[model samples]
Target: MDLEATKNLSASHTIGNYILKSKLGESSFSTVWKAENKITGGEVAAKQVYLSKLNKNLRNCLDCELNFLSSVNHPNIIRLLDVFEINLGMMFTEALLLDMVLRKSIWSSSASIMLEILKQTVIYMLSVSIIFHFCKSEYLQSQDECCVFLVLEFCSGGNLASYLQQHGRVQEKIAKRFTQQMGDGLKILQSHHIIHRDLKPENILLSGKESDVVLKIADFGLSRVLPDNHVETVCGSPFYMAPEVLQFQRYDCKVDMWSVGVILFELLNGYPPFRGRTNFQNIKSSSCLPFSQHILPGLHPDCVDICSRLLSANPVQRLSFDEFYHHKFLRIKGVGKYHGQ
Candidate 1:
């Protein structure tokens, strides 16, 4: 049988030297798998995307994702080890090249992991990558029945949303710690002109051994580099979205910070700040709620301050990136009790 015909022989199959073990996740245009490298005994994630399912929009997004991963190198972002193409429904096939994928998943949304995040980010900032670091990115080709495999680093600690749902919301100190790490990572992304339009808890992954878990931002499907002009896409989850996004106004990186505000509020308060019976009502709640005064009662003063500024109705009045880098709330040593409580 031809390589393409051979691959089509099974839904549960192997591509190159990588064997598909199990599925990790599936979205509109892609499905992720927990795969293994036959030669190395190493675990990796392959984002399997069928070419047939991609519309122009998804294709553009896929292109953007490849470009960003291939071009950028940060410890927090998923490392694109290799990208290659193989025929799934065709007759001819090619082998794969390149090796070494990053191991370790996102850290859990808790105190220790976030602390690690801050520590690592600070360390990276201190050290300089004076020379260009070369990382290989491979692409796989398949048919109408073809697919593209995006081999990504595996994150074992899983995503924050599942963690929160499983363990319930954390206290103020723990929540603040995790959010601080998020700010650190987000600031770095912003510095590189990358805007993660969809910045929810789920997109954050926690990876590490049982003793230590570290968080990393994942799923760049909705992420994009900053455009020359103001962005006007009315995208993002309704509950965590900025007022301006829902209003379809020109916005920038501040939108992600707005998401941070919502995530922080939920982590600290056990529910989102905006509550509504309908989607429209929820969008409206972003503007109408007195979040500043309402959320301040039990959180630490600095916590409330940051959260309020982040959740500001006016995008221009929202907390800037530098503010997060030097925020007093993040600097406080140890797990101090919530003072405002």
Candidate 2:
């Protein structure tokens, strides 16, 4: 893998039968590109992972993601298309092909408009979680470098991180819409015994079609399935880390709720709930970010309560999926509001 040039393979080249057209995104180990499948005349996203340049043991982050993708199928989850391991020069690199989702402009001038957008995004996440419950593994192809590739749904809408950063702060109604969707997504994952170890706005993606504003949860690099006993890995973002996760204790799906709190806080406050001057400060004090009480006064009372419970210091004390589903925040009773309507 050409470290410098491979940064945005999505824009530069195609993996196999796909014709690369534009760059979608890039991370330290992988790059996502938008392309057209020459065979079917369909659009797809290609994620190029540079495994040879990573740890000699072959960091299985991509593999883990592939494994999860193979096992789970969801409408909100990006679908894996194919895997490519072509000769870069002297060695081979890994790339995952996926469907691309289109992005739309976020309008925050009005609560009603934002509410509609957030509602659609959450609905998309709910679809993904629903599909995850009955997932089946399928073989695409294997890489020579011991890495794997997956094909997923194409969401042209892009990721939530850029959306939040661009919009700064979302209105209360809009934030609640997003929170419901995110919470529903997590509830689905938890129901199926899947844990989105890393739950952040960046990992959440949007759909391309304007009529279908589906928000997908993408990038399972740090995700893991909890065994019957549960997992003890100390992974996830510093800002969204649960207190128990920070303490290096055995944790379960509740960690995702902790992340949900952080995301909700950011949606309302424009920044992470636990922001510090430096990375060290963020990690050191992140576990104790006072739930939305002080930072989110303008938010609805029920919304604040939900965020507080999700951000509880004790994982066990956090709200469960049932409680979250029936929370007052999601229970909009009037016609002007959204809920069962």
Candidate 3:
């Protein structure tokens, strides 16, 4: 849309006591904004989807995200506060208000403090077993649809890749802590039968600042809920691709484990397990990360073993995501979250 058209779209968009403040991010079919609840005086991340694109697979993706996030209460998973469609009159004729209060995010205010407050809120919500099931009060006809908006808790910190670039390779202690949390997150997903197909560092978000940071798995657009034992989908980033995925063979959740291995390798060695001058070379090469303790001087033997098993070329040989949590390395509680990064 032209700037003038974009302004026209913005002007007519509003919900009960919530005013759009700033744009947070956007995809081809959606634009997510940082909105403020005027009545509650609290901030939140709002995702607005173009109603024009909500047909077939695009609609299915949004529905999947809503279902998965609503059932998930893990600290490592992103939270969905609300979902509703705004339509008709090119003004605020309908409003779906949510009670969940989110704190200010990185763009506009005190981020670290906001995260601490949100952590407490998450604990309370989970402890009390407060869950909201997805519901649609009304569905507009395909012709009258305007937009679908989703409210989510803000993840203020940058992605793990950005953090890695700023701080270099993190020491083993911090790396293990992060690895353990990532495993825990995956374990939760396994229990829920959801596969986060995209498991690269960019989808792994750093939730807080400095020593108190938390890692969360974000961006579920490519994720799928597979109840069957396996699925045949040729997707995900090539650098983190499991052998089967690269070969276009049938695969399942184990592919996520392979990505985890690649992530850990990059964190420790400042590079991914797979690297090449060309994408084709990276995709076709069978070269695996050397688990030699000599090459990874500072890492413990157990850590090296864990990484090797996860990056196994044979999917059947790779450690399952749950197995990583029980690994001896993760059992050793690290000092704290990213002391430097």
Candidate 4:
């Protein structure tokens, strides 16, 4: 019912038809757990959102995530299997009962008795109102205090961030392979007119074994569908965010291309091209993308071209999604013929 209670929840807790086995990850307002279906015995990642903790923007993101994931069936996107909510009223009611029991001794006086009656009456009316509202509306009110769970496909190989940490600066061949897979995923996003405002290595997941990993675009918490192809919301990780977004300018899907460029650069150089203590400093630092001198001369010209074009500070100069997907680096001969482990 509250933050503390939510934190105390652990393995063995059953929600819907799945049993939470362990925590996969968490954020300020949500937690992801590795769960198993009781009926089918299939493993899934259950993302639980605390409805009371969401603000308007976050609620919109939640709606977007649910809507996008539910309608799409792409190999490079996370699959949503089911969604359900568990009401916290029972827990709240139990706590209220305990509080009343503790205060029973103070109700001996006539005045205290009248006060207790009034409190109970108010509680009864509030409970009735909550029940009626829940029945009438599809969206849960903050007062409802329920946990919404999104059961998704579990990627056991972990995210690209961890992979990079384990094996810093992968081979150029590997980087190209990964980029191609990311392009495949982005094509799906582009077709739907969705802007994945938060695109970074940490948000890309690797499924399958190490030798045959499949990259999936994930974490749509900051994503939105843009029919007009532009948005003004300046939200994203600073290191991988596009300069236009950093400068508070309206941007389009090209912003994601900027992030992909950053990822490609990181995969080849072991770090992002820019660094700053703040967004202002970050934008200033991004005027020049620093390709490692030792590695630059060795990289393919096509690779260098794509990386530079995608990281252009001027959105007008940046590569569009179609261009990036069809660039020579991703489509050239022998690009997908990596044999190294």
Question: Which candidate achieves the best TM-score against the true structure?
Answer: 4
Clashes of 4: 0
Of candidates 4 and 3, the better by lDDT = 4
Off by over 4 Å in 3: 1-17, 92-145, 277-279, 286-295, 333-341
The candidate with the higher TM-score, 3 or 4, is: 4
TM-scores for all candidates?
0.76, 0.71, 0.74, 0.83
Ranking by lDDT: 4, 3, 1, 2
Per-model RMSD to reference? 16.2, 17.2, 13.4, 6.0
Tens-digit lDDT string for candidate 4 (1-341) = 45557655689977779998999889888888999999999999999898878888888989988999999988889889999877655545655766665576366567777667668856875786677566745454565667788999999989999999999888888889999999999898888888898999889998998999999998898888885546888888999998888888888888999999899988988888887889888888786545433245467777778988888888898999989999988887664323232
Q: Least accurate stretch of 10 residues (summed lDDT) in model 2?
A: 93-102
Cα error, residue 37 of model 2, in Å, equals 1.2
Q: Model 2: how far is 60 from its true place, Å?
A: 5.5
> What is the C-alpha local distance difference test score of candidate 2?
0.65
| Ranking of all candidate structures by their TM-score, best first | 4, 1, 3, 2
lDDT of 1 by residue, 1-341 (tens): 33333333333467777888887778666678888888897988887776656666667667777888887676567777777754354312212100111111142556676566556644543342211122212222322255678888888888888878876767676776678778777766777788888888888887876345566777887777788888887767788888888877899888888888888888877678887777678777888778764664556778888888889989888987788657788887754466423
Question: Which lDDT tens digits does candidate 2 get at residues 198-315?
Answer: 8898899877563445667777777666678867777777777877777778888788878887888788778877777755676556545555445644455677788778777777
